[model samples]
Target: MNPSEDQIYVIIFSTLFLGGLMSTFVVAMVFIHRQRQAQNKQKLDQIKSEHEKTLLNIENEIQQDTLTHVGRELHDNIGQLLSLAKLYLGSSKPEKQQEGKETINQVISEVRALSKNLNLDWVESLTIEEFIEQQLQKIESTGFCKTTFEHSIELGELPKDQKLVLIRVIQEILNNAMKHASPEEIKVKIWKDGATRTIQIKDNGKGFDTSIESSGSGMYNLKKRMETIGGDVSITSSIGNGTLIHLLLPN
Candidate 1:
């Protein structure tokens, strides 16, 4: 009853073929699993990037909105009070100038109030162009650095958040120029090119090497702020050539 040679050969061939097919199936499964893992990682990375961008945008929106409210309060409330004080001073009788010294006292109080709210409210309410002009006027009043501001666009309609961010960025840049650039003249230009708004600040001062490490928290914060709003900042300067700060934001 022993099996013939042909039957034994057939049985062996069948076993070998099945074994090879099982091995191929296992290898194919491993390859598919690896591919799936790679795809999942890529998707996770994309989601993380998108989430970061969304968070930054939200931060910018909140900051701008808060500044706008503060700006309005300064212009409508404090600014009016100052104007009223000036009017009272103008109408005071000459005979009672000494006795009407209360008018002067009131004016001084108004001035102090205005100064207290200048940076917070006045800046928040002004359009980008108006804010820049006011900043230049302030710098000129100091008589330390001559400032020039140029604008090509009517920026009355710019988003409040964007205006606030731009104002802060420019303020930081100008402060750096005045403190470090030692420049006699500082020029700031704001304009729109197609769909993009640009701000350029240049100073004819003693420049520094950009390659060296800088301990400027203002500049770093400005960069972070701009990034939150999907804006960009660039600096160009050398040991004696002067310094230039450029900011670009989408309209």
Candidate 2:
């Protein structure tokens, strides 16, 4: 009942050939998988490098802006106070001399407040809500516009780097409102919506059409910046109406 010798040899040859083919296929699959893995790793590394570069630029811009603000305060507020003090101190009257002493004390206090802003180390400890409130106060102090801030609860926190980016972006938005919008009211709100933390800035200023693309790259840059931090920026506006900007971050 056994097969012939020739039949057995044919069977053995076919079996060996099929096994070789299977091994070759497996080796090809492994090579392809490894190639894809390498490609993915390279892409991730490039993204990491880009994110770090963006963060560095944000840090530099923040520092420069702080310096500029400090310089202005020194020249406008402190310098004027010093001049007034000098005039008062030069008077022979006791009341005028006493006024000069009080003015000098005021100047000292103002200088100390400005000194804290010279460095960015304070940003590390400051929360996002606090920053927004401080900016609003500054705007109100200018008498250029009335400011309002509303928050339902404490917004979630972000890492220091992300926090800095958000801070700069918000500052730019507020500045744009003052420079271009000239709105009577600038209102900011913060709240949590589901899995997102939202910061909304509303200004009753002359708004522009959203349909038409802007010649400037400001909005584009803002969107890209939010993307870098896994967040998003949304702006809604119409001519003669007002502008509303929403800065959204994931919880």
Candidate 3:
């Protein structure tokens, strides 16, 4: 028997209603997905902004420190050399004149070396190894402590931002050791294994317990800074055994 008109109308109406519900569900899903994508993008942009700001602040601090160092060298070292050269040149002897000429040449060389540090562009061309050696030499020259550096392995090239961050971090650690630890000797070592690079700075000075958060090593701030560069900072110390800090980085 054939279907009646009333039955056919009911069947068509039911089909239309189900199709409408499906379309509404799809639209809702699309709307929710787009909203989530927007939120994620905003979060990412904020994080990028914060990272850049931190990097800029660090660069400024490094520049300021460099300027301070240059000022001290000019006053304490170069000034003395110039005074001696003037004295020698004023003497009435040929030997004295020759000595003055040599001293003036030395002064010129020293000035040239200092001029390089006045700008941060030199940092781009310097490797981590070279920077460490320079810092150690400076520390030793101050007569505050003896310093040594050992490079057991070479690290691959690093991004410029990462390199700058590392330099600042190392400088902070050394400064802290000298100011707080009062160590007679400071040592820095670098090594690498597979994809991991490590820098270890050790001081044979009074140490603090790592368990305490207020140990004054500024480890908390250092750790946070390392996180910004995808690195890790760890410390080992006791009350009198001295302090050892390890900085870890990925290839």
Candidate 4:
């Protein structure tokens, strides 16, 4: 070939090679930019979620503090003043004042109970029946479903950790029933079989097949929690039949 043709071939090859290199570099740059943007977006979302959780926790703490203060005020100050009034009012007679005093006593009892229930940490002060009643009372107060509690299990020396976990498990179960099962009535029955304490919760709702997969993580988490607490959960349900959840606590 002539020198001119050889030079032309070399220039064409160089130009094509240079173009390919530039195209590759541009594509790589775009990919890196997208990767960095994705990473930054993930970080921002994580930060925002953490911030919201922190705020929620702080709000809960403040509410707990307010409940504690109110409970103390009711039991100490209002209860004392009621007693003083009972004495003054009874200074005249018994029949007329007894009714008033007894009413005041009932109020005091309710206030104390309310105070105890306002904070879950103080649930240790209640018996198993009382704790269950408190939870049911909360549910009933919501007016979502009619709840009936039958507790035959006597209160013994139960561990505080177990008490707390049991409360959480009960709450979770009730939450599942309310959210997923759409129950009109929920019945909670507690009984003891020697060393085994049982909590049975039955709901008249559209039960799902337990053998099949479910989108609800609440049931899975409930079972996980019971296992974590050295307890076991037995759930029975069909498509149309109502659901029954039993928790056996080996204490």
Candidate 5:
């Protein structure tokens, strides 16, 4: 069964054609898989964005509710006490009257400062830095400590949700300093480097064991929240030294 040379050539050509066709189909399949992967990533990003927006709305509602509760306490409780003091001062003996009046004035000043922060409208309109300053000012007004804040111009351009989350984190840190640090002063610095914005909070109070404190839910939550936004949190501390919190945001 010997075949001619023409038949052999035809067989070789047919084999090459089929090989080329298979290669093309494999390439097409790879291209389709990449397209599907990209589509899935886009959908996931959209879902994440919607979730963050919902969280921000909840934060706003909580702030408003807190404002109302504080307003009521200031008016119903401290306001009435101050009025009573004023009335008592009016009836006191001459020398005692002067002392009472001076005491009342001091209380009034502190109360007025606190009242300024109770306004929901004012709180709503503030930028992140302004809100931080407000909280710091309240702590400093107690006459126990001083707080300083510095920031780059780029910080003001952050998205509202980003700013909101940062403010809460800073608040938590500030509260920790005020309650536990025994710090004479707290310093806050904010700046931008390329696509990243950073905030550094330093205190002069006695630092603590980082390993022991890392187990706290507050700090863990802080790290988690930052991670959700593609950011990071780092803390450094040593006993008798101070604590430093470095926050990095991908802006």
Candidate 6:
């Protein structure tokens, strides 16, 4: 009743081969699962980036619409009112001339200020470097913050949109430094890489965490603006240390 030697050897060989095959199958399944998970993660990241870009574009469109409406209102409604006031002043009774003159002067002054806000002639006519220098001059006149600007790239030929966006970014940075950072000095630099433009804004101030709860809407808006314009923004800071904002844009 004992099995033959040849039969026993055949049984052992069959068992070993099956065992190896099963182990190979298990390993293959694990590798396949890991590959699928990695693919899913990559897809998720792409979707998130696309979503952020869409949201930024929408916000920029809304901002542009609002600015256009406000500009038109100032030029048409407020400007016409001021013109009417001036016309009335010329024909007012002699006894009331003084009062009318004062009223007309006040109206004219308000109109002029409104006009400046509505008209971005500075952006259209001046290069980014010149415009930044002019802004620095205004800040310097305040005597509140010592400002310095340096440039390694000639930004004179940048597109108007890019120049305007950079200008606004710089303005927001300076405003934040003055109002919140409480820094006595601020520095701005612009340079270029092979096909990229770089801007660095730095301030010695009480820095905050870069977490969601720590930053305000201003920083969020700035990041959104940069993304909308195909640029990237990065902020680095810590408590008691200075804040540095780096912006990069394709040239």
Indicate which candidate wins on TM-score: 2
Which candidate number has the best lDDT? 2
Instruction: Estimate, for each residue in 73-172, the C-alpha lDDT of model 1 and write its tens digit.
Output: 5687656656665665566576555434665676567556645553445555667777778778978899978888888877666665565667667766
As for candidate 1, its clashing pairs are none
lDDT-based ranking, best first? 2, 3, 4, 5, 6, 1
Candidate 5 C-alpha lDDT tens digits along 1-251: 35787888888999999999999999999999999899999999986986586457547754775687677867886677677667768875886677667768866776776676664445346777787788788888898788888887546556656666676778778888877889999998888877777889999998887888554677887786677666899999989998999999865
Tens-digit per-residue lDDT, 1-251, candidate 6: 35798898889999999999999999999999999999999998986786566555544653674478667866887667666666666774774566567767776776666555555564567787786688778778988778899999886676655666776777777778788787777888988878888888898988767775544687887886776567889999877887999999755
Looking at model 4, report the run of 10 residues with the lowest lDDT sum. Answer: 53-62
- Which consecutive 10 residues in model 5 have the weakest lDDT in total? 116-125
- Clash count for each candidate, listed in order shown: 0, 0, 0, 0, 0, 0
- The positional error of residue 145 in candidate 1, measured at the CA in angstroms, is 2.1
Q: lDDT of all the models against the reference? A: 0.74, 0.91, 0.89, 0.78, 0.77, 0.75
lDDT per residue as tens, model 3, 176-238: 888878999999999987778899999999998888887554788788778888899999999
Cα-lDDT of candidate 6 = 0.75
lDDT of 1: 0.74
Model 1 lowest lDDT segment of ten: 114-123
RMSD of each: 8.4, 3.4, 4.0, 11.0, 5.9, 7.6
Tens-digit per-residue lDDT, 114-194, candidate 2: 999888888987998899999999999989999999999786567887898899899989998998898999999988877
Instruction: List residue ranges in candidate 3 displaced over 4 A.
Output: 1-29, 141-148, 215-217
Model 2 residue 243 CA deviation in Å: 2.4
Q: Is candidate 1 or candidate 3 better by lDDT?
A: 3
Pairs of residues at least 3 apart in sequence or in different chains that clash in candidate 2: none
- Candidate 1 error regions (>4 Å): 1-99, 102-121
Candidate 4: segments with Cα more than 4 A from true spot? 1-120
